[model samples]
Structures are given as C-alpha cells and as structure tokens.
Target: MKKLLTYIIIGSACFSACKKTEEQLYTAQDNIYFDLNFKDLSGNNRRMDSVMYSFALFPEKSVDTVWLPVRIAGMRRSEARSFRIAVDEKATTAEAGKHYKSLEKEYIIPADSGVAKVPIILFAADPALTSKSVRLKLRLVPTEDFTVTNPEYDSAKVIFSNRLEKPAWWATWQGELGNYSRVKHELFIRAAGVNELPVAFDAQVLPKVLFAIRRFKNFLASPISWVADNPQEGYTLEPAGAGKYNFFSITNPGKKYLLELNPADNRYYFTDETGARIV
Candidate 1:
C-alpha cells in the first residue's frame, strides 16, 4: 500500500512539471516583435534600411501635425497594448514646445491591430523655423507587450523647414524661368541659389523630374536654356494643370514633356514640340 501511494505522488509531480514547462514554452512563442514602418514615407511597405528614417514636414501649409507609424511584426494579440516613446535628444535638434510639441501620453496599439501612431505637432510659424529646419528624433522603447526587433528602424526623424530649398533635381537643368504659368508658382529658394521647381507640388516629381533635368543640364543648353541651343528654341520648365508639368520648348509650344512611369531604361527624355522625343 505504501508503494502504491509513493507511485501516485511521483506521477502527480511529473504532471505538474510538464504543465509548467508547456506554459513557459507557450509564453516564449507568443513574444511580440515591433518595428518602425519606414514605408510609411516611401510607400514601399519595406524598411528603407538606412541610418536615419527622415520625414519632411511642410509647416508653411496647413498640415500642423504628422503621424509616425510603428508596427508590430508578430502575430496580433487579442489584448490591447501600449508602447513607450522617448525623445532621443542626442539625435534631435528641435526643442520641445518651441519647434514641436511632445506627445501627451502613451499610445495604445488596438487589440488585433499591428499599427500605432505617435503624433508630432510642428510649429511652422516658429521664428526658429525661418533660419533652418528643426529635427525631432524619436525612439521606441520596449514595453510589456513588445520588443523592438530592429534598433535602426525603431528610430525616426522629422525635419520641419519652412524654407523652400531647391530640390536635388535642379542640378540637372540649365533652364530659365519666364512669366509664371497659371498652373505653377515660381520662387527662388534662399540658400540653394536656384529657383524652386514645385511642378504640381506632388510626391512623384522628384525622380521623374530629376531624370529629365539632369539630361537637360548635361547634354543640352547652348548658352540659352535646358531644352535647346538657341534662346528662343531651348526648353523651359512649365506647369501643366492637375499636378502635372512638362519641359516647354518654345520651338514646339504645344509639345509637352511626358514622364514615363518605370521604364526599362529609367531615363526620361524631353520630347520635342512636335510631340516626338528629342533623343
């Protein structure tokens, strides 16, 4: 009878040990991993894999606040989660409450959702904005619900500049501006020593405009403009309506510069006034 009792007790202890181990394993498998979504800026849904995740804020416009998104990469849990955020002063140049406002409190990622936002309000009218851009560097800290898997993506920066700087695409064109077109606005960027070509003020203008501009700057411009050798014949930057623009060459006033999306060669050529490609 003692042997029988001893066996019963040993079996119960083993069962308890197995149950605890199973619980521990389940907890480990349910660990959450989170990362900043850099594609929020690029629209690619993939991390940019760069040193700094930078976002541009145009405070001159009515957009006073921008939301930076953080995402959890693992399985979504039924319970809601709150993540911690801290300003990395070493990475930030903007002052709290002056250039930008701090987030009021912790933000909760909703249950079964992978995304959360940290809203940063930019003071576009701040006097400091006139001189240069103020940078806000934010970092995601680990919380009970999740761990930041990639430190590089866990940090992001917001650069707020009221000044209109000449885009990098301007280096390619030797174009001159005439009277402002009804469709576009012309202003000289203060520090860039070049005119601002805001062709329709949309996001996709950078790469397309750069492809044509550099070609004009490198190959064309015969003491006149980016499009032609003669003053009256060369090309100029002009705005077309509805967030579109083209290289306007006087020789063919009706011909519009067309930017092809994702061509195999990836080189944009300015077409002639006859609607034929100049190349």
Candidate 2:
C-alpha cells in the first residue's frame, strides 16, 4: 500500500498581534525525553513495526487526548491487536483498573506489502494534571500465527511559555549571508508596545523594484553591482542607519528574489526585485 503524508498549519496569524498581561515574563528551560519499547504476547521482539506519536499543551492543569500511529510490515496476512498506554508511577496514582484498560482494535497488514501503519488516539482524561513532564508506556496483544520481531516506540513533549510584547517591524529580516540563494523565507516584526502602526512604503515601489531586477538580471552576481544597477525608482533606498531606515535589496540572474526590510529573524533579508527568497 502507498503511504500518505500531510502537513496542516492549525492556527496562524499574519497581520494581527497578541496582547501581553501585567504578569512577570515566565522563562522555562525544562526539557523531557521519553523512551518507548514494544513486546508481543510471547515476550518476543516486534522489529517490523513503527510508531508515530504527538502531544498538545493544555492550560489550567488538564489532561488531553494524544494520537499515536502504529505501522506494521513484513506480515503475511491481516491481524488483530489490542494496545494500551500507561503513565509512570510518579505521573499519576490511578490504579490498574478500568481507566487503564487498553482499547481493542483490529488491523490488517496485506501480504507482501511494503508497510502498514495505524493511528491510536486516546484521551489521557486527567482533569487536574498540569505537570511539565509525563511518561507513557505501550502494551500490545496480537492474535494470529505470527511472531513479534521488533517493538517500535517513540515519544514527544510540549513546552509552554508566557506571551510577550508584539514584535517590531524591523525584527523580521536580521541575518548575515555572503551570497544569494533560493529558499522559503519568513518575516517577523516587533510592535515595540505601539499598537496600530503600519510599515510605510509607497504602493508602486515593489513592482518597480522588481522590474529593474528583471532588466538587469546578469549583473546580480556581486551585491554592490546588483544594487547599483537596480536602484529603487519611486522610493529612496533606506541607508544603513539606526532608526531612520534599515533596508537593503539584491538582484539575482533571472531567479526568484525577496527584499525584506523587516525579515522574520529581527534583521534584514536582501532580495532581488522578483520577490523570491534570497539572502
């Protein structure tokens, strides 16, 4: 069977800013790691299986649902299985009663198939659980004439922090690079506690800048030559200074370009006129 992979940006905000409270800024350097192991009914290895795991953060001390995916390979036919995840002794005092019982599920790994994976998302259901660290254990039971070769397991943790002031416009593009290249780029700005402020730029400036680079694509090898050839037409290029202007531009040889005055890194991103990601 063919495998599928997908990525979804759950929540994102581009032009909006977050508000900070009067509470002292909280800084945390806590890091936690998890170790996972899997075994079958006969106490043997299950090397032919893989696992996917993830976790989310909840405020006000609450336990949330976690999703885990299990993949099996090197199987002859379909199979039935049951699995459960446990917390460490230090994590919780809940007994091994109905709450800790494993959920029953069945899976089929096709004959001569490359690999098969299953998702097991369950609720931890801890209402007053706000600890920064948690441990999980996996148990599996298989039905059929097969052996558990290699048990596969992995773990992840989430970090929490307090929100800070809104970022400034100049905080977006701050970095150092020797040459130009193509890649995905991002821009971030700090608000400096001032709300409803907009970055000033002429409406016609970007298109004209792009047109100049398109006309002089060959001379973009050298940053000096590229800037000299492709000067800003309608707007004045801000010189390197403290607060007046901190912007720069670059032009590549007919490639994509980006000229970010306020890059996401809190520095500046030098780009050509074509709006491609370039350093």
Candidate 3:
C-alpha cells in the first residue's frame, strides 16, 4: 500500500508540473499600444475621431510560432469585418534560426465586442525570432460585409523599431542642415574630425536636429528651417578640398533634412578651383 501511495504522489506532481507549463504557454501577452493622430503637410496636428485599425508583423520577423496583436477600437460587437496584413518578400527567409517568412492571415473582428483586442498568431518557418524585435507591414481592409469609402483604405505600414542597436548615419554637412534617425533621441559623439577622434559639442544642438527630424517624420513634412541656436557650439564642418559637393538629399517629404559631402562613385561632389576630395 505504501508503494501504491508513492506512485500516486509522484504522478500528481508530474501532472501539476505539466499543467503549470501549459498555463505559461497560453498566458495573455502584453498589450501593444500605438497612439494615433493625423498630421497635414505643414506638420500641424489634426484630430481624428473613433478610428478603426489593425497591425501585423513584417515579413522579415514573421515566424510560424510568432503571435502578433491586432487591436480594434470604436468597433461594435455586432459588426463583423475582415482585414488583411502584408509581409515583405525581401525581408523574409526560410532558414531555421535566421530564416523568416511572412504569413498571410485574415481576421474577422466579431460584432459581440466592446473594445476588443485580438492576438493573431503567425506560423513561420523559424521559431527563434519569435521574441526578437522586427518591423511588420500590416494592412487593414474591410471585408465584403463593409464598404470603405476612401480609396486609401487599404493597409497601414506599421514600424516596430524596438531593437538593441539603432540606425546609424555617416556623412558630412555643409552650410545649412543635416538629419539622421538614431535609436535614442539622446545623441552621443561617436567620433570627431577626419581622424575620427573623440570630441564633445553642445548636446543641446543635437536634440534640436533630432527632434526636428522626428517631427517631420511624424507630421510628414519638412522642418521650416534649421537653427544653430547654440552660440557656444564646438563642432565645425572642416572644408573639403576642391571637388563637386552634394548637399543632403530629402528622401522623405518634410522639413527634416540630411546632407552628404563628397559621395563617391556618384556625379555629385564638392570641390574648390582645383578638383580634389574634401574632408
């Protein structure tokens, strides 16, 4: 009888452990939040009312085991509609650890909802990137049941910029302005001068440029002008030798700007009377 009791106790413990594991697997994930607002060409704020939207993972980060959330607001419980999310082919892979593919999934927001949140799980070829930060291109569309009046009512490209390392820029600035996006708004001096030596400058100036670019991107407009507000600013643009110099290119339509000094292999170059490379 003692041996039988021991077996029962061991079996009970194993069952409890399995139950705990299952519970962890099915736990609710944290809510992904995005504050939405509308902006015009001038970068002014325009309020939107009861907007309905959904988001999906980018093809590069979509894994079979990965689950993403699609939230709906101002949706009624009795209103059911279908929506689609898009994934990029270039960003997708098929390898085990490194390969990721975009999964095309359709969802129907149930009408029985009162402020409902939906978690859409993506089944991709790889499982490792399930938790890694990746950008997903998502499109929300109305199903046959609903009609969208706006022709632009296709999908919204949502960017997930959470990662360990932020984007970097390498270029030179001339008279007016320069712009680049960093992981943190807090700018750090990686190097200074042609020798790429350590240096310091007015931290306040960096924020002005960074904030301006962000405002441009957010407002989908350019900064009206660049400012060199700090009189005590230490950094200076060292003159490059005689060559054709190219100013910054406005990749996006906005007041924010970026400048490139002597871009190699391209026709654009900055030079003096005698043709030579500038610093």
TM-scores of all models? 0.48, 0.26, 0.26
Judged by whole-model lDDT over C-alpha atoms, candidate 3 comes out at: 0.34
Q: Candidate 1 lDDT, tens digit per residue, 172-237? A: 332532222211111122112234455453567766555544543444222123234433434455
lDDT of 2 by residue, 22-119 (tens): 12222211111122235889998554222322121111111223344444433333334332323334533333331233434544444454233433
Model 3: CA > 4 A from native: 1-35, 38-80, 88-104, 114-135, 151-153, 160-279
TM-score of 2: 0.26
**Model 1: pairs clashing at backbone N, Cα or C within 3 Å:** 227-235, 228-234
lDDT score, residue 5, model 1?
Answer: 100
Best by TM-score: 1
> Candidate 2: where is the Cα deviation over 4 Å?
1-67, 75-101, 110-116, 151-279
Residue-level lDDT of model 3, residues 99-188, one tens digit each, is: 334344665556664322334343333323323544344444444433333333333333332122322332322111243323111122
Model 2, residue 238: C-alpha shift (Å): 48
Pick by lDDT: 1 or 2, better one:
1
Number of colliding residue pairs in model 3:
34
Highest lDDT scorer: 1
What RMSD does model 1 have?
14.3
Clash count of each predicted structure: 2, 32, 34
Model 3 lDDT, residue 194, Cα: 19
